[model samples]
Target chain A: MSRLAALVRGLDPRLKLGTALFLGPALWLMGLVQAGVCAVALLCIVAALASGQPLGGRMVRGLLVFVVFWVAVKAGLDAVSGMEWAQVAAGAGDLAVRLAALLLLGLSLALSASARALGLAVAWAVRPVAGGERAWKLALSLALMVHFLPMCLATVAEIRQALARRCPRCGFFLRMTVIPQAVIRALGQKTWNQTLAVAGRGLDGPQAWEPDFSWSGRDTRCALVAGGFLVWISLSLPFLS
Target chain B: MITVTDLDYVYPGGQGALDRVSLSIRPGTLVGLVGANGSGKSTLMALMAGLYTPTSGSITVDGCVNPGEGRAVRAVCRLVMQDADLQMLGATAEEDLLLGRARTDATVARARELARRFSLLPAWERPVQTLSWGMKRKVCLAAALLDDPRVLLLDEPFSGLDYPGMREMRGLLRESRAVGLTQVVSSHDLECFIDLVDQLVVLDTGRLALDGPPDAVLNHVRSHGVRPPCSWSAGQGVRSWDEESL
Candidate 1:
């Protein structure tokens, strides 16, 4: 693995997650130039984090397709609402950049940390406010979401392919309407199966374990660097605007 | 041992899946559950695994009444669903094996040993979605075995396996049986388990059609939409599909 990948992977999951959470709102609140800079930086970070992973290429491609589709839809809506062409273009571009950056931020964290580590980080972060049990439940929910999203997407794709094969000449509107219903039915069955599988393993019981997290000196240094960067961004906000 | 008394499972939509089905499974015996599509074999497995409450009836697994002592039953039972994709709860084989359990050193070592035994050690860290259908099924089986459950239920365990995969699965089941694990395997393919199973239970249209040893149940399976094993049809005694025996 590259040094950058190693460093990102070695960082405490809590720090990585905290930075991502803070950067999401910060990216949107910044001026376009600042957001653009942040987006570029996030893109590089995501690339580094995703290096050598099997799902990295597919994830990046899927995200790119979604971003393009989102931009087109936003621009078309703005145009339909009778906005000025220049304003529509600018608004759509700004939203697309920020959205891409936010997604990249999330992707970087997901690629760097295992789902269990992320769950532990979430539990640790939420424990003070939600209590240990609720925090653990929330963390489990997050982990299941992480685990099921890809399966859901795969089910959607499978339904789409089956529909296309069986109804080759179906109109666009019919395909769109049928796909969601089919996906819901398929996902419902899958969800029930997953629930049974989990129950069989006795995972539905009360949380009996506590989260154990240790911080390293490197984590402290990384947190300080992140704090200084956030301070600089906060101070520069007015001038950038 | 598992005992079912007049089990009736009706779907929420009033569709009856299993009607008046009753059977008994002896301890430390491998039972083959054979039926056509939607014949309630999977439903019966789920009920025995403590996954669902029977609409009407009682299921006892090793002295624990299901839906009454479901948690206790679940503690000693593990079910491997037909669709391995849905059964997988982790991104990788190792993670799936260690999921929902205390990940102590001993558990981790057990998980690793199971992976190695199942030939999953090479791809232990790879995403399960990237594995082939047979490999994914093996991962599910390995995960099910990680807890050392007394009762193991497999639904359509041989559906997507190739010849070699089938051989490996048969070997695994035999190994489990040898170790006194009570296993109920549901399958549409008779040849896969005809010789291996100690007893055969056939369900036809959500009702018990036949239940006995393979020799007695083999001839009647055809009337219930299941084909007799090739050797049986060829006037030969019940035979295994294993090529080594051939």
Candidate 2:
């Protein structure tokens, strides 16, 4: 892979999350206008491929589920609003594709980056404006969130497996009882102790090792390309509208 | 060497955990800290590990007061708590072992070696939460030993291990002792580590009840809510605890 491609793999998760946060509304607006649907899809495909993670069966299933749910909800609303079937189908298709593109952006970012790096990146981003203590605390909290995501997923899977064996026909109420208890037990002590351990290891406050995140020449080129694309999109916006 | 002088520790809620507990641990010796549940073994180990400041006394590791010289104390001593799940901070077993170590070829090699020794080679890259309770404990042990700390304190090391796992841990302790690593193993099970420990310290309700060589003080273990080891009982040809009465 090229340097930019490799850099994207290790890019700060904060940047990726920020990009998604910014792009999400843009994609939503584009969907509303029924414009740039193809462009957004192309960007999603490129981002996914560049992330170097295969669209696994589970991810595909999840995407399909999301798309189906979106279309169903749209159809329901349209039916209640007395819209024709053809118009409803078209609008729902547009919304589904747009939502898929947004989800792809989030998945690409989540799969490619590390949480600690994201926390550090958040710290780095807010360093100029935020006080040192506030930045560090925010960084730690963000890092904890990153760490908790996978742990929560694993806990759910574990509880599901156990429940499947013990009470295969159990209802949602049983899961409500068991899962939270198990997850809490699994997650509660670790966070507190690990945070203390981080402090105990003499790494409690602000991180000592500064991350080298200075934009390289390649990054400048990429930025230029992105700027050109943004200009092109802005210029096309008037025509599309 | 580790020294505790009139060590008194009280929790924030004003509950005493260790009361006037004082002892000197010789360099490179394996000590067994046996006590009943809530008998302050964990608290004592945590204090010696520099995790807590002594409320009214001093604990010095190699002449450095623990609370005052925490960094210095941590540089030489490592504490592996009873709950391995809480102690393991790494996402994966390998990461936990290499947590604070410099990411060099030598450090990685040492981490791999320790993982192998602890029977965690199969799950070296596996997330710690996916591992079994015994495997998690082993990973924590490997992480503690990865830095080659001079003083290793284990709280209930054999709590969740099987017979073979316990034997493996005992062997590791012996090897660590052979390599001049001082170890304090705190456990409720006397039979598991009784023979291996050169010194045995008994705690009863947050106070030191007995401290001496294993044979000398093993007789008094029963009085402290801890059953005396089989060897200690059998040595006197007594099957019942009351008959061996010390």
The best candidate in terms of TM-score = 1
TM-score, structure 2 vs. true? 0.73
User: What proportion of the real contacts between chains A and B does each prediction keep?
Assistant: 0.51, 0.15
Model 2, A104-203: lDDT tens per residue?
6666555455455566677877877997777777766676677677667877788789888999899999889988898788777566666555554434
Total backbone collisions, model 1: 0
Which ranges of candidate 2 are over 4 A from the true structure?
Answer: A1-26, A29-78, A81-87, A124-139, A150-191, A205-241, B100-102, B116-124, B129-132, B236-246
| Model 1, span A32-151: residue lDDT tens | 776787788878877876667777988888788888899999999999999999999998899889889888888888888777678878888988998877887877777778878888
Please identify model 1 stretches exceeding 4 Å from their true place: A31-37, A65-97, A114-116, A208-218, A237-241, B243-246
In model 1 chain B, where is the ten-residue run with the lowest total lDDT?
Answer: B237-246
Question: TM-score of B chain for each model?
Answer: 0.96, 0.92
The Cα error of candidate 2 at residue A206, in Å, is: 4.2
Q: How high is the lDDT of residue B14 in model 2? A: 92
* Residue-level lDDT tens digits of model 1 in B131-167: 9999999998998888789999999999979989999
